[model samples]
Target: MITEQKPLHSGYGPESTAQEIVSDQDLRGKTAIVTGGHGGIGLETTRALVGAGATVIVGARSVDRAREILASLPNVEVIRLDLMDPNSVEAFAKAFMNSGRALDLLILNAGVSFPPELKDARGFDTHFATNYLGHFQLTLRLWEALKRSGNARVVALSSIGHMIGPIDFDDLHFNKRPYDKNISYGESKTACSLFAVELDRRGQEYGVRAFAVHPGAILSGLVRHLSNEDLAEWGVTRNVDGTYTSSGGFKTVEQGAATSVWCAVSPMLNGMGGVYCEDCDIAEVVSADSQLQYGVRPWAIDPTSAKKLWDISVELLNIQKDTIPNVGTNLDSDRLLNVSIEEPVVNGQLSFTR
Candidate 1:
């Protein structure tokens, strides 16, 4: 378990940028996939990773725009992906598998918030579907490639909004309850944290680890739906200064990408998985009454809740019984075992034909 006694670094607060953390690191031959990597913090993340010699794949719903934005980068590729469409996810995974490439880092960073009520192609809540389930499916589909790298890390972007609510299993789709955007987005963010914890629990043994990140607040395209007045009401944007303050504290796009890149490449977190992180280190557990700040919430880090969420995800995605090649024959037993697929010897070279 991660302890709070670890000293905190003050210099790298809300204003730090991604280039600051990766200035001296070498990432040659590493391949990273960043969902929603075309704009905002995602763009900053891709830029930093590419600058450090890593080949970066930017997954976006708008391939043309992503291509145009990242055209100048030498090792960047843009692929089409819409989290709302499972078929799009499946096709993307198939293409990746066909390429026979191994993933060193997977950043599940794409998300939506507080949109008008709508259902996905599968008839599920749009926020929950795009924010959580889409990544869940993508992860499962890419399980083999991730395992092959032998030391892979996945970083899921959660949010401070998770503090607003707990997972509502019975009404996760928000069918019964009134459709409140904040509540729906909150539940999905909470689920993102839980997903990381549970994923680490299952994948740690295979050298695949997972972490959930709260990127801090930044005025990005994510707030396009919210009017200036709406943002001010949430205390996210200051009227006088005409600036945005994150829920915890405002962070630059680079600083927002720091924790994620840290979780991806930092040696300090080796052998540790399933933890929530911020400001380039493992986050501490905060109390219910404690002022909302830089640490993670209790529900976001609860192991029991993580497991429960995993079970529900399995049923919802219909993945409880599916098995990956050479990994195992039955996912039912493996699901219970939570085995890590990143065993060193496998290295993503196993043949699927048994």
Candidate 2:
């Protein structure tokens, strides 16, 4: 059975820091991997997990920089990984698989925000390729390691931006439609959520479960693409001291990583998976017309779309995995795209999990 999309009141809130969530727990002997774990909330996540005794491997594009950033930490290893490059992703997965280690936690923590329109080597939109497809490929390639644990969790860092749009199955790469950076980013995030929904459904039977998390808005490198005008419009301001401040609703980097850590290690979520979470708890499902600042949109969690996305992703990657069956027969792209109401006009102040 799928976990209901409702909060259990897990005794954690938006202000809860990642360290606070793991203070009582010990993760000795466990092995985990965090992509882009060298900086931002990913760094805090690595710290908390390592502090709890888990050996963490931080995947980064720059091995030297990652190692330098994490040099003070023990039991943490930094390896090279570039999400835009399929070969890099494959190599990283292969190295881990070679270790014969059981992966207890796999956090899909690396992602790109709104950047200039670009494409990967395969001519796929950079946002979709990097944020969703790359992580999807990595997760599948590590299936054996995850299953070895007999109890493993995979966390996909989704965002509130998912409400901006659902997956445009026919135009994922913006081939037909003119590319709007925010929409592309939103669709990628929605894909992340759907991936978790279907992945949990398939992996739960094998002792591997998946979760999609929305780490509340923190001022991180994710906003580097936004211009000063965009920042001011979003109620953010820069002071003479060169520091930034938000009018409200922004979280500290430590607080932002709490939910991902919680979903990864919290006993409160045992036997539950496939739910989109926020503020350290499973978020409520909000109607498309609702003007809520939080909660997940229905389109992001639709099971049919999730299965269709899985099949589409496999075909795009041209990989064969006999363990999971095909479920994308005669999928109607138009219907799936139209299932959710059009996005509402809002402040566009989305909380990023990366």
Candidate 3:
């Protein structure tokens, strides 16, 4: 089992913001990519990272809007990337690779939630497609760049919703089971945690690491599909006072972005990977009925499950086993120039996993 320990940066809590966590840290030469960087906690994360001297690439489906929002930021660029579209994901990865820039931080922050029943071109449910598969393909496509960085870190934005249930592998796409929007969202988030654990196990020897984060509850564009009635039903908003209620412990956008920035830039987490984190710290393990305060669940941190998820993902994505690069293999400087690249294929269909 991976050790459950606190992060080295000791002073922050659930209320800390991105700026506070990154204080005094200098990312002068680092390169970062944050999906959904145009709004909400994602935007705040970009702002904080850029302010600290990192060159950030903002990925969004709408390039014009993303560019406009990031116009005044130095060393920042916006690229068109729609996680829901396989072709678009491929194009984005190709563009980044062609630039030959190594990435120091990669945050899988873009996701859709609780949408009406729909599936991608590949027939995977929409929530799973965008929230898990899209990021999965993007990470694989950029694996070479990540390995080249020599200390790259990948962060997937998971959520407390994962506590609702473990992944139902047999019916991952809700093909056989009746669909519940909340359950679908939880499954995707659970996949996020599984991905992080597996990625770390596969890449740690190459100086690359991965982490999964639950950014706490916040009102963001992620809730756009929900109406006031839906919000009330979820207890996220109240009708009497017109105020939002805590699904668990509600946080501000900045606070929600704190753990993300910390995972990206903090030297404190230097040698650690594959852990689920929250509130700017490596979360403690908590009971299922433990009020959802802070920390990871046993299922989220289970290595056996994580590896199984990886194998299942490789099979589902039709990624060849031989193509799965050996983790931690020492590479000569020259070999680093030509890292392995895998083509994403799902049963002869060119489909991108979210």
Which numbered prediction scores highest in lDDT against the true structure?
Answer: 2
lDDT-wise, the better of 2 and 3 is: 2
- TM-score on alpha carbons, each prediction: 0.86, 0.91, 0.87
Candidate with the larger TM-score of 1 and 2: 2
For candidate 2, the 10 contiguous residues with the lowest summed lDDT are 331-340
TM-score of 1: 0.86
Steric clash count of candidate 2: 0
TM-score of 2: 0.91
User: In model 2, which regions exceed 4 Å deviation?
Assistant: 238-243, 321-353
lDDT at 345 for candidate 2? 22
lDDT of 1 by residue, 56-133 (tens): 987777678789988888899887777766666766666676778999999998888767778764578877887888
Error of 2 at 178 (Å): 1.1
lDDT of 3: 0.79
The 0-to-1 C-alpha lDDT of every candidate, in the order given, reads 0.75, 0.85, 0.79
- The residue pairs found clashing in candidate 1 are 16-255, 17-254, 17-255, 18-254, 148-347, 148-348, 202-338, 203-340, 206-342
- Which of the two, 2 or 3, has more TM-score? 2
